[model samples]
Target: MADLALQFGGDLAIGPTGDLLLSEGTTLTQQRVLRRLLTNPLDYIWQLNYGAGLGKYVGQPGAPAAIAGMARTQILLEAAVVASPAPIVGVMAQTDGTVNLSLSYTDAAAGETSALTFSL
Candidate 1:
């Protein structure tokens, strides 16, 4: 099933036809991955453990390795990602306190590799 498309900041996307955009295939998988990483674990009532809660790292002492490890673990939990070739997660903490994250993974359903990058 296709999911309602979402912009980078989690806003609903609109299509050219004056309707809501829908996402599938690699795009959908990527969206799901980002949602999982960004959502707070306790915020989702049904599944308390569903998220990586990456926001918790913001404005705090940076631990790139630990953050990367947490991201990697969470990415693997995503059903769309392939298990054999684990996802690659890279985290960089800047002097200004912004943390950048990069991820590379194989999309199981699409049988293709994908990459995503974002900041916290």
Candidate 2:
């Protein structure tokens, strides 16, 4: 694959029509899942692999905590990965099996798992 960048530019939004608005960037190129979006304008949140971030987690504003400031979790059920940005593409699965997708988050000592169950 060619070296490229995928930008997710936007606020913490699940768009008026349900589409998510993340940030714009150069590192998020040709990647498909298994990543995180940390430290938006939010507080009191915790997340695990492959989800949108809203706390003190990654990168630097030139601060170690200001990477891609905002993003939305691409839960298989929340929304489908129709298409990726320019120079970026997702790795399509090559089998028919249980696509077990799970997401965990904690806030104020309380935690929950948001699952996006689906079939192949």
Candidate 3:
């Protein structure tokens, strides 16, 4: 089954037909991965530990290694990512207080590699 398509920041996506879009394949996997990383833990009532909560690090001390490790672990938990070749996570803390996150992983369902870059 496909999920309602969502933009990077959780906005609803519109399809060419003037209706809500649905996501599948690589796009779906990327969306799910982003959601997992951005959502705060315990925010989702049913699954208290479902998220990496990357936002929690904002305005706090810089810990690129720790953040990257956390992201890598979270990415591997997704079913779409292959477990053998671990995801490569890069976290860069900018002078302006924002953090850049980059990752590359193999998508199990699509049998192809994918990369995502975003900020926190």
Candidate 4:
């Protein structure tokens, strides 16, 4: 079975005269998973207790504890999702107090290994 989903956060009206953007094929599925993993639990409509976004680590000093907390959340989120096999998640606190999140996963359907990085 082919898994598919509308790209998450496709609300931007950047088309010619403002049309909602869309993603198809494996890209759509990948975007959905990334959005879900990055979203804050209750921030999205009807999404309660569902996200790996910042968590309590936000606003706290970017210490080891803070980074570890965020990493734990990221790992949990990846495990909860079904798009990819177990992912390798890395979290690091930058000098400017931001966090660098790196995620690596093997796309079974596409038969490719992919890695993504985000600064939060």
- Give the TM-score comparing model 4 with the true structure, all chains together: 0.61
Q: What is the lDDT of residue 58 in candidate 2?
A: 22
Off-target runs (Cα >4 Å) in candidate 2 are 1-48, 57-60, 63-66, 69-79, 86-120
On residues 56-79, what C-alpha lDDT tens digit does candidate 3 reach at each position? 887776567778988999999999
Better of 2 and 3 by TM-score: 3
- Among all windows of 10 consecutive residues in model 2, the one with the lowest summed lDDT is 83-92
* TM-score, every prediction: 0.92, 0.18, 0.92, 0.61
Q: Which ten residues in a row have the lowest lDDT in candidate 1?
A: 57-66
> How do the candidates rank by lDDT, highest first?
3, 1, 4, 2
Q: Give one digit per residue, the lDDT tens place, for model 1 in 52-71.
A: 88878766665787688789
Model 3, runs deviating above 4 Å: none
Cand. 3 TM to true fold: 0.92
TM-score of 1: 0.92
Model 4 per-residue lDDT tens digits across residues 96-116: 777777776665556666676
lDDT of 3 at 11: 80
